[model samples]
Target: MVPFRSRVRCGASSLNMLKIAGAVVVLAGAAVFSQQVQAQAFPSHPIRMVVAYAPGGATDIVGRMLAQEMSADLGQTVVLENRAGGGTLVGTDSVRRSPADGYTLLFGTNAFVITPLLHDKPTYDPVKDFQPVSLTTVQSLGILVTPKLNLRTVQDLIAYAKANPGKVNFASSGNGSAQHLAGEAFRTAAKIEMVHVPYKGTGPAMTDLLAGRVDVMFSSLVGNTEHVNEGRLNLVATTGAKRNPATPNVPTVAESGLPGYEAGTWQAVLAPAGTPAPVVERLNAAIAKAAKSPRIVETLAAQGMEVRTSSPDALRDMLKKDSGEYQVLLKHTKTTLQ
Candidate 1:
């Protein structure tokens, strides 16, 4: 029952309200766009690469190498922070719960994927919680026994372990570590019975192995290559499929009468979910360059690691494949969290 002029005026006011709302929305969107653009200029400040190991471990070594090279490539300081505990769960969980701004990253190892399978309540889901940046390397495992063991080769160790059964004990870097998984895989494949003694870190594990507190340990050659060459430890077998050029005389587990046996460790870079795609690609490219550098390649080779420059998509697929296989292995191994 309003007048025609009043109706027209009301309609005009409603149209103005709509226009104001639209303008506000556009302004808010612009603000967000500007913020995102600012974020895309990543590494504006120092970037932290969290390594889940002590300073002297292979993980820390690789992390430092990447950090030094990445800092140069990104034109910012890239620092390594050691978070050694909970079988790498501590540092990995830190990255998982951190902001997704691409500044905080994780230098995750094979244990990162295998930890959840070995534990009852894993803090993060490998596939769901983070995005794979790039695969850094395939780190071969070395099965080293104490000099006092008097075992000449892997076959001898397996036969000895089988003959002795539960009396033989092997040491691992920690519970739910790749070292632990490697030892378990060997036990299952060789059908040998051995008790696993878990240490807080690889340093302690290697210490005990040297003191004969433990019989044997499957460790990365990065920290033990010198000792092996010095004859302080006996090299039984390597977990790689072929002989590593670094240790040309060493035989593979497959070659040591355990056909179809292959287990190894690896490392990759990951960022929290929700990081920008462009930034992820940039980071991937930087890592690819760093990992492929001749200096890094030669250094890693000496440590018995092979460089693998996988794309983000490729790394994503690798995660899926590895996670599926780990699930099967976990079920078969009957590995349960305590």
Candidate 2:
């Protein structure tokens, strides 16, 4: 038999535990209610979209366009901030640390996933750290070579690379970018040896490629079509299963000699995890609406980007799919990066 005083103390202790549990439940309910209220009051101020690349790169160009359109639709200014470096890690990771409000967002590409996988200690987990808003667009990459190389066709480039071996140099936006993997795929498929030169971003890499400082780059044709028109860059092939409408004359890399070779990347918007569900829905709706706009569709089409908007869940599935695909590519090519 327990003492009467001991029983009383145990009863009081149980009562205190119940009080603590009740307080926790109340706090959780309050948090959920606050999120709902915040979502209702969202866009009361300017929202910022961080582009993880240089100003002139495809990601930045497309990001600015989407921001402009989404701003008009959301009745709030969507400011773009470029934070490029470490193969897109610097800017992308910065957004991961931002508050879980919809005010701060990330305009990211496939590189967003690939960049983290390259590091031994990844800065963030794509699945755990972000809430994907929606995919903005998709585009095929161009296998561009400097005209100074005098390479007019994929075959010519292959022959030159085979003959020159390690003397052939390939450039990419950064160490683990889609461009980097595409170049590696080309080298493997063509059975050639080419040194990789990585830049801080595609803009800097394009600058060097234009000046003949680099021999080749697998890049977007967004803002560089005039260079090819003026004979400054030779776009020998594209990396798409089908011919890109923007450059129908350019054959796919598979048709150019490397059979069964295809690679491309998509662009999407993401917010830090724990963003309000209502805010995510609002963002997805704006993206879907903007993607259907005639001006936005035409402009993206001109740049070779297919205007393909998706739900947040669809975008999340894409993230997982690309993560698996890139993992295979990285392993097959034996690609490593710091």
Candidate 3:
């Protein structure tokens, strides 16, 4: 009889100990969940956003707009660092080799996607080296000339270049840049010949174009608008699929005797591959929100850009398609960087 009672008491004590252990396990899980919550907050430190072009360019403009908005959204400082060189390769490579944390990011353009096509050996792979965050905006290109040139239309420029041949020099930011390719593509499509004068950067190129040292340039509509309006530069054909609302009367390249010819600038956000999917989603959400802001929309519209926000997957798809198209264009046209 004493043994039966003692055994029943021992069973109850064991059950109580099991409950205690389960409670401890629950507390431990709560601690883990709290830590995960902190981690998901993201951007715990200052983020370095790389702009792969010199300041004052279209890429820089978009990057600054996004960095400001992202800083506000993420509750951290977002710094825009310009690493301009090698047709944007220098900055892009820096981001590619950066740690996979969300602290480092790249704000790039169609030039980044098309640079590899012009080089014999690229330093980094576009699809493999980076993850897309969002597509920010698409900008149309305008053909601008110094006021001294007195050029009116694309036809006038073509006639002048055809007559002068190598005498007419056009300025480009750098070799293999979107401006460079746009200039070359226009010359090829229109069957005109113009000497390409590659500058270390667009600032110098624009300076030369404004000083009448260079005959013409294919510049993003953003940077050239004020100059055109100030009568410092002459407006010519725009290189877009259709006429842009900012300059509706300006004929598109395709409509201006070169049918099917289209070239324009675009901007996108990217992060180092292996960044957490949650972080990417957070960044994308912030970007899409900022793009819809009336201030941002009006600011970019004033600069001749259309705000086009897209999901990360959509941006990836656009980059992939553009990469293939650039490769084909390079091969068929025998384009190369010098």
Highest TM-score among the candidates is held by which one?
Answer: 2
How many angstroms is residue 295 displaced in model 2 relative to the true structure, after the best TM-score fit? 1.9
lDDT of 1 by residue, 197-287 (tens): 8766677788888888999998889868888888899998899888877888889999999998788888899999877777788889889
Candidate 3: tens digits of C-alpha lDDT, residues 259-327: 988888888889998777778888898888888888889977876799998888888889899888887
> Over the stretch 203-252, how does candidate 2's per-residue lDDT look in tens digits?
99999999999999999888888888888899999999999999888899
Clashes of 3: 0
Which residue pairs in candidate 2 collide?
Answer: none
TM-score of 1: 0.89
TM-score of each: 0.89, 0.92, 0.87
lDDT for model 2? 0.89
The numbered model that scores best in lDDT is: 2
Candidates in descending TM-score order: 2, 1, 3
Candidate 1 has its poorest 10 consecutive residues by lDDT at 329-338
Candidate 2 residue 89 C-alpha distance from true site, Å: 0.9
lDDT, each prediction: 0.85, 0.89, 0.83
Instruction: Give the Cα-based TM-score of candidate 3 against the true structure.
Output: 0.87
List candidate 1 segments past 4 Å from native: 1-32
lDDT, residue 96, candidate 1:
94
